[model samples]
Target: MAGSYGAETTQGERYRLSFTVGGLLAPQGRALAEMYLNRMGDGSTERSSQAKVSEKISEKANEKSDKNAGEEVGESIAAIRQQAIEENVLAIRTDSANRRVVAETTRRLSALTVEELAYLAGPDSSTSDREALMWIAMCRYYAIVGEFAGEVLKKHYLTGNTHLDFEDYDRFIADKATWHSELETVSEGTAKKLRSNLFKAMREAHLFDKKSGTVLSFLPSPSLADILRKRADSFGYLPMRESSL
Candidate 1:
């Protein structure tokens, strides 16, 4: 299970692609994905220049939003593009093995369900994608949302339980000293980061109830379900454990 983005340092804060997961699962995300492909231009991805790609994506993004929303679309798209780049879904090589490549190109954009894309965009959307996207995200955060958290959630928060208790978080946090292979112990700062990455994003995505952090049922959006219908095998773990969070 490959994870998502690594880590991004803006104003001295360490954030993952986790913050923007909801946006990618929303209706707007479909448009964003389409715009991303369109910007690729015949799949050759001649658009290697970030400034140029940003300008074009921004223009397209502006066309579909209110003045205020439009203002942030470019930045948002650029961020997505950057994340995609980090994930290796996009390539920016001029040439390889005498194969000269001048700029960035779409490397391996998967045709995904809204749910799958959502899961990809959001770090903790589903157990399956969580496994996959979590790895990609780990490259940046240097933290692992490994089986320990999942196992704890299953044993303590799950087991005929559909909801979660803060105690579960406390347990995970207390025992999260071995998540990342490279880290000798999970630092307070790192645990806090995991909280933000896992719990916070899960809340926003409606995977857990706000007040209690209770586990939620799995209900794919209609559009997402339709997309998943043909790709069920790719996500064979449906009807997943509610506590897989």
Candidate 2:
């Protein structure tokens, strides 16, 4: 499924299940937000600012790259730079474990507003706020994850059943696979990693308890909540009642 972008299913729904990249990359997101702010603050046009930022980020990566590093590291940096150019975000160090940091970061950030990006990078943003916003960003970027959160998690929360385990993920994937051939094409190993990464992200976002896997209390900050509410259907992705907001 390396090049599998996705296709519309029989049900007229398109799903992109290529979420095997990074998981809740808050640090990278913060770094990118700061870089964006720096570039955008220079009174330059958006296009020029993005271009300069991309060039500088690539130069910085090349400068810091180890001279004696292996070919893989060099290639990773090149890919990272290319993704940075394509995504308009600064490229950071390559993760040996996950080489899609820049791509994933830009995708998540694309879901947010400049104000939201600033909040993520600002001094007032707490860990909880960042995590919640990151989860929202992920939900906005990936429709399948958003569907799981909205259809499965929200429904479970409303029904007073908070338990969320691998069984729940398996069932959700199985059900979606019927309407989403892309999901069906994912290898068992890749599917397992996807499930693991989703749970890891949810755990970090404080959506559930790490020990018991039970849904936890979650309420975004007033500002963040306001941002989401302004976006059509954004708040619906979270397992929260509208009246609660």
Candidate 3:
């Protein structure tokens, strides 16, 4: 999150492994997508569109009885928008008010294709679809997350394993850190936060049991799979049986 959103594996490229962003936050994602679409439909520029979304979030915050709490929420969302702009995720650079949360959120949202984003924010998407699609978005956005999905989750399923433990995550991270200098630099506390957030996201996506840590059985719907299949390397992020794919 401290560096640019993402980079290729090339030597000259800027790559930094960041996991400071929290879980899926599906509700917030949907809200932001809806607001973005609406603003675009109304002929607002990308900059203005994000500004409007921030304002709307602020207005909603203002409705709360506690003025201080309301103001804080407004400020946070507004700061996030400014951060997005500064990162060039949203057009037009601004002051550096945004932090890792802003960088991660904007990068995640941008990772999805317009069709994927529309489906995610639309009325027809089921809860499961939204969760799965969000997972796909995260994979597409962050190489670290995508590699974990492809390496650990997919391998675990293929090997007929149905459970995941912190050790699996620790081992994977440790192994990857050997090659990825970006990851090698992470402190233990940051790595723990990364693991916690990842597990939470998997649970929310219904890919893991909330209480038991058992790998849940899930496959994307045919329509959803079809959408993902159209994109190179995207469908493989999901842990699916070989025959199912």
| Candidate number achieving the greatest lDDT relative to the actual structure | 2
Q: Who is ahead in lDDT, 2 or 3?
A: 2
Which tens-of-lDDT digit does each residue in 1-245 have in candidate 2?
21221111233655666677667888777766656554545533344454565455444434433432111111122223353455545444445333467666756666666556666766666888888778877876677788788888777788899988999989998898777777887888888888888888888787878798788767777876765655647666666777887
What digit string (tens of lDDT, one per residue) describes model 3 on residues 1-245?
Answer: 23333222324443445545668756656655554444434434444454565454444423432333211111122334553354444232334433444556656665665455555666667889888887876776667778888898877777789788888888988887676676777777887888898888888888877678677767877756766655647656667774775
Q: Which candidate do you rate higher for lDDT, 1 or 3?
A: 3
Rank the candidate models, highest lDDT first.
Answer: 2, 3, 1
The TM-scores of all predictions, comma-separated, are: 0.42, 0.73, 0.71
What C-alpha lDDT, on a 0 to 100 scale, does residue 138 get in candidate 1? Answer: 26
**Model 1, residue 184: C-alpha shift (Å):** 4.1
Q: What are the lDDT figures for the candidates, one per model?
A: 0.37, 0.65, 0.62
lDDT of 1 by residue, 1-245 (tens): 23232122233322222221221123233334444534433343453564555455445433442333212112223434544444334233422411111111111122232233333333223443343322222222322232323454334334667666656766654554344332334466765555555555445345456686576544454443443444343222222442332
Model 3: per-residue Cα lDDT at residue 61: 29
